[model samples]
Target chain A: MDYLEKEILVLGCGNILFGDDGFGSEVIQYLQKNYNVPSNVYVDDAGLSVRTILFNIVLSEKKPRKIIIVDAVDLGKPAGSTFHLDVDEMPEIKCDDFSMHQVPTSNLLKELKNFCKVDVKIIASQVQYIPEEVSLGLSNVMRDSIPSACEMILKEMSPL
Target chain B: MGKRIIIQPVSRIEGHAKVTIQLDDLGNVADTRVNVVELRGFEKFCIGRPVEELPRIVTSICGVCPWSHHLASAKANDAVFGVTIPPAGKKLRDLCNSIAYTEEHILHFFFLSGPDFVMGPDADYSVRNVIGIAQANPEIGKKVVRNRHLGTQMLDIISGKSIHPVTAVPGGFSKPLTQKERDKVLPMAEEVLEFAKFSIAFAKENIFPKYLDTVKVLGVFNSGFMGTVSEDGALNVYDGKLRLMKPDGSFTDFAYDSYTDFIAERVEEWSYLKFPYAKSWGEGFSMDVDNPKGIYRTNSLARINVADKMATPLAQKEFEEFRAKFGRPAQLTLLYHWARLIELLYNAEHAVELLNDPEITSRETRVPVTPRAARGVGCVEAPRGTLIHDYETDDKGLITNLNLIVGTTHNNAPINMSVNQAAKLLIKDGKYDQGILNRVEMAIRAYDPCLSCATHNLDGRLPVRIDIVDSEGILINTIQN
Candidate 1:
């Protein structure tokens, strides 16, 4: 069996151009540099158009047992905090006013859920710079939470 | 000597612009100038990012046609990685492109450009918007609103967001469609098809003829025409070789890979925008030419002229009749709204066909591969016109450079010329009265330019200032979105 055939895929999505909204891309870049994962594990930077991410979901030969997405989300938490949630836990995240891209993510997810069966996980980092100009470096708070984000995702993917 | 009149901040347009009309001392029109105030920097920002990330990064530049950016950027990345996706991915990408164009056309005609036609040009600006449409004919107006909303919803369902879709990645879509999702869109697609058919008849019989008699025609000279041309010669909006047809009826088709060779942009001192013209047409101003060859019009007019046939039946019939009436390759600039409507009808019908295809719901969503760093270029026909994105990546696949040629950029010269022509024509006899400003604005809005989409710097910031001075002389309520 191929390495990518075994482990699930994790997609990091956001607009790196829009200040903190780029948190997902930033984290993905970090993971690409640091993490040494199982052979089947695939991670991608999806950017602002999550709809296009659907193609990536389709191309995986072995259906990812699970999929994880890391992004900077505004769940009304303190500016530099991080939160993790799965498909079941998604409802708890208030979706009253989504960033314009959120509408597309919701729409893509709706369409994708019907065709594939993969556990969906989101690790969102809240930040002050939603669209404000920011640097590539992660905030201290989000930086600290990276380890936990990685740990939780790994645990979820691990076989008991 | 020529007199100049400046119309600053032309009213009822999406972006900022200033128009200058150059009139001979005898009050005859001499020349025209239009200055678009916005400046974009997409190339500078493309530097230092992975080529694969270009599609996802550039998608945020516009809220209207992110799908175009997504496809173009993805194509660019595909070039760098040297990956060719399956035919299904290409078809799905085309479907997404078609949806984007329809949604944008609906918004432009029904919401933005609809008022100028449905309501008289002389109608008060305040009452010439969607609200005005609702107030005038409640039922007809509701249909327009519903169509636009339904189109947006359909786009939202498929592409993730209606305006700027991110789901169109390089190689293929992020996932495949399901029977349930396909079912949700089937009925809506049918409704849109019905609405478009009704709208086309409405436009041809009732709307267009009414406006034709008094409609202000701008630009006496027929200039260069350019658009994406597929190998099959259908109006290739998703991706294709670009074709440029000169006023002399001679045409040249360049593979989008050879884009840099055929297209050359000239920078003017008066405006921040650059004028893109065909390279074979010669560089700089030509004196032997009676008409200004440097100024060329793009978008719908160019797309219609460059393609041999349209994919949809209704649009093809309309294209023939339109050419017969207005000459082969119609140049009546305001008639773009009509052409856009025709294309919308085609796109809606096509979207339905793609949605019904069982293969579109296939389980094989993505094929994994290794990333090889290289240069890539992607081009698609956007709602406005052909949009091209080019990227150069480092060994690790990070983008080192980027170049994006949006539809609006291609029309900078013609837009200026159109505004100038309208001002000169309407303002004849030296009286600042009656429909001059409206006519000028209508000319610019014809292209449906989205300036925000041109903003390229992913991390760039602008100094936005909002001033409210209190009695004590202190600035209050400083905020940003």
Candidate 2:
């Protein structure tokens, strides 16, 4: 319930151990270093445990008004291209695809928006490369886009 | 001509996998295989990194069970540095492990595999999930969610973060619990204990009775078992020698460092995962369900069967009832769930006992570690099974070599055999439906396999595609779920 005191919650979700897929966590690092956000706004680098955090938010006695999730995606677009997606625009995720580190998080986000009456927004960036192996650090494209992603997240927080 | 039925990306588990069942011209079960995709090059990635960073780095291996990797890595580092932690440090680490076990067991029982029994396996897929369970049994669902929250909160108080902990350092815990902190945790531990009691009783009265037949026959297979036990042969998840028990209940206890001498990993051409067998038994590896050779299981059922008794009183009573019903070396795969609850009860009680200890609040938690060139192996009975982290460090304490035999990997062969046994019995004459397919999945889920930990992944998306192919390797049908 203490977490519900925040009006705006910004979550950066990704595994930093995988190349380019770490865009969200990097964006969080950039934001924490460059911006001084209001006390009402809460920011977290959720990494692969984003589902558990979202689950807590959905089932808590009190809820935040708006939630923004920053993540890396395989959108087949040019790398580092950022887009805003409402909860309804997210694709349906089958239960079979659910894993602690996988896209079953999308299903939880969708449920929070539709059932829990919380506004959900996703800021997804196209990744240049996600290593088939356990390579760390971000690609140049994702590394460069961190500043822009931070700016976009700041602009979204202005209304709150 | 033989036909293959593929169920891609088994749902409600920790990772993605494809289950293929092959039928001969007579429409009888010919073979069944579970193919897993490996997240390549993890050991290579660790090369040249400072050994101290491994405990932190390994947390990213799987989000579901980071504590297992973190603690195992820390213990391995302790051996590499050649230092023994103070009694307080070791107790704190065990306390954290027990709390984590409580959270994971609660999640698995009520949220994950619980639906199979709570909502009934034959229910429509749409109504056989956490959400459906909540809708059907709101009161129980609410309690489950609340208790899980409490567990996380307790973890947050003990360790700075519940998701990826940084407290368990090489020599000892980085943080010490003050008396005030211990007082705060005691109440939460008590609450979790109450819930643990309720959970086992509820399952016994409501769920297990309805599925007794399934418990007796589904995915049943004969295999050896492996777990950690104290010198007294009491179940000890935190620190103990490895106990390898044969199907006849005979066993051998060995130091964890000599694990390679007793256990061997076998590679299969069809899968990226390695199948581990008990090589010390001197029997060649075989996956024959009725007469498995060198095959063994880990995880909850294995731990309960291998140990002579539980360390805690309540759990000891439950263990007695379990053995009385199933006998020694229980082969019923579904009994894993039953065993899991017993362990949950044990962990909750263990946590409370550790908290009440005077050593828990001692300031002498860690010792200084000196770098050395040595090989060390650290093993702990993770919530899922026995997790081992073996590391070879250079003179500068840099990791030169590393190998991790995670819980799921140890059960890889048995998982395959269980799948085959279930498929052969349930899909006779090629008669099957989604329910039958789910029953097949129940076999795998009972292990509570964390394939994501076995082979890691990111991106939050795993696309599943099932293909039905003829004997000539031509795709006859394609199904995407």
Candidate 3:
């Protein structure tokens, strides 16, 4: 419930079991450990349960002014490359195709923006290697990108 | 002259899977197969790790059913350490399981598979989704969303986090329920119970009647069933003896550790996942739709079928009514939804019953534990089906071996059989469209099989691509939706 009281909310979404997919969660860790976050801001490692958390936020009485999501995606770009996308810029996903566990984080972000009137932004890094096996820890390229992703998230929070 | 039709990444279910239907030269359905990507190296990942860390580590297995894994692992840890959890600890774990079941059943019935029944299965794909359901029936949609949110809120209040719980430990729960916490949760439990009542009544009155015929015949097959039951032969999800029921409604019960004596897993060359049948039944495995040899099912319908009665009163009544209509061991695949709702009622009522128990708030939540070398098996009725965790540890308290048979894996063979039967019935003379293909997928969805959990994918993307090929394995067409 305290999460709803924040002016800004940052969600790090991905599975830590996969190599590069843990980037978003790692960014959240880096931010919390190294930065001086404002009291009005709340950072969460949403993990694979992003939809559940987002649903709770949507139904909450109090809503954050702005929500930022950090994720690792397959954007067909060079490994470790990062980009920012507004809610509208996300790809169109079929409504019926949505899943609570496997849904693209952007779809929920868009829904919150249109339905709840909240400003939404996504910070994404192109994944380098997602292992087929049960592997932990990120690839070196993704590991190197974590600091920049953390700085970018901090800069986004600065204006707020 | 023959043709093959594939439906990849069947939508509206957990994880990813593909369905392939092969046709003969005359264009009649010849054979069918359901393929899944199984996650490898998982058990290997547990090797050399401290056994106590399993309850925490296993939560990462599946995002959807973390509580089930959390508690099952905790119970396994208790067994391994040869410690009995205190009464408060056991009640707390059961309480969390009941609440988790309510949330999962509601989500699956209303959002995941609700579209097929609510909007009509033949409805356009665009309008047959959660959003479409909201637009079509705003009143019901509002209630569903609010009630589901309440379920999540209840979990958050009790377990600290709804997705990946940390309270369950080797001997007991890490946290106890204070009087104030129980007081806050009591009203929420009551609200969820009322919603559970409304859900079944609403579905019975509005949904099931229209699909009665389909309910009886769609994906119908004969198979044995499995579930957990109390000593008095009543349904118990968290703790009980395993009941393996024959297709004729007769059953035999066994202790959790004695599972190997009754059950065995068979692996097929075509699929990475294993097929688990009743080995004690003394029949070799076969998915032949006409006469399946050793096929059996687990999940809501199976649980309802295998149990003598429900422990909770409301669910017991519903079980009687369900049996009156479908007979014992209901073969109707679509009835899983109905059975799921009934279990929801049971879980909600069970939660309230636990919350009202005096020992639920007792201060002694955990018992001290000393670890030694031991092998233990923990079993629970996951929302999808029966989940079992088998673990072995060295004297140093480090895991030596681990094996997990998730709820969905138990239904792997049956899912393939159901899809095959449905496809053979629906697609005639190679004539089928999107709706027909979806009907085929409906057969699989009835199982609510969580291939993601079965496969253990960290990145939850199961891209489904349906490829149509000719008799000679030549590419003919491709379908992606």
Task: Give per-residue CA lDDT, model 3, range B160-232, as digits (tens).
Answer: 8777689999999989999999999999899999999999999999999999988877888899999999898
True lDDT of residue A9, candidate 3 = 91
Model 3 chain B: ten consecutive residues of lowest lDDT = B456-465
Clashing pairs in model 2, backbone N/Cα/C closer than 3 A: A102-B460, A103-B460
CAPRI-style docking class of model 3 based on DockQ: acceptable
Error of 2 at A21 (Å): 0.9
Q: Ranking by lDDT, best first?
A: 2, 3, 1
Could you tell me which 10 consecutive residues in candidate 1 chain B have the lowest summed lDDT? B460-469
Candidate 1 lDDT for residue B1:
37
Model 2 per-residue lDDT at B364: 94
lDDT per residue as tens, model 2, B130-227: 77787798887677767787788888888877887899999999999989988998999999999999999999999999999998888988889999
Interface RMSD (Å) of model 3? 5.6
Q: How do the predictions measure up, each by TM-score?
A: 0.71, 0.95, 0.93
User: What RMSD, rounded to one decimal, does every model reach?
Assistant: 11.3, 2.4, 2.8
Which of candidates 1 and 3 is the stronger one according to TM-score?
3
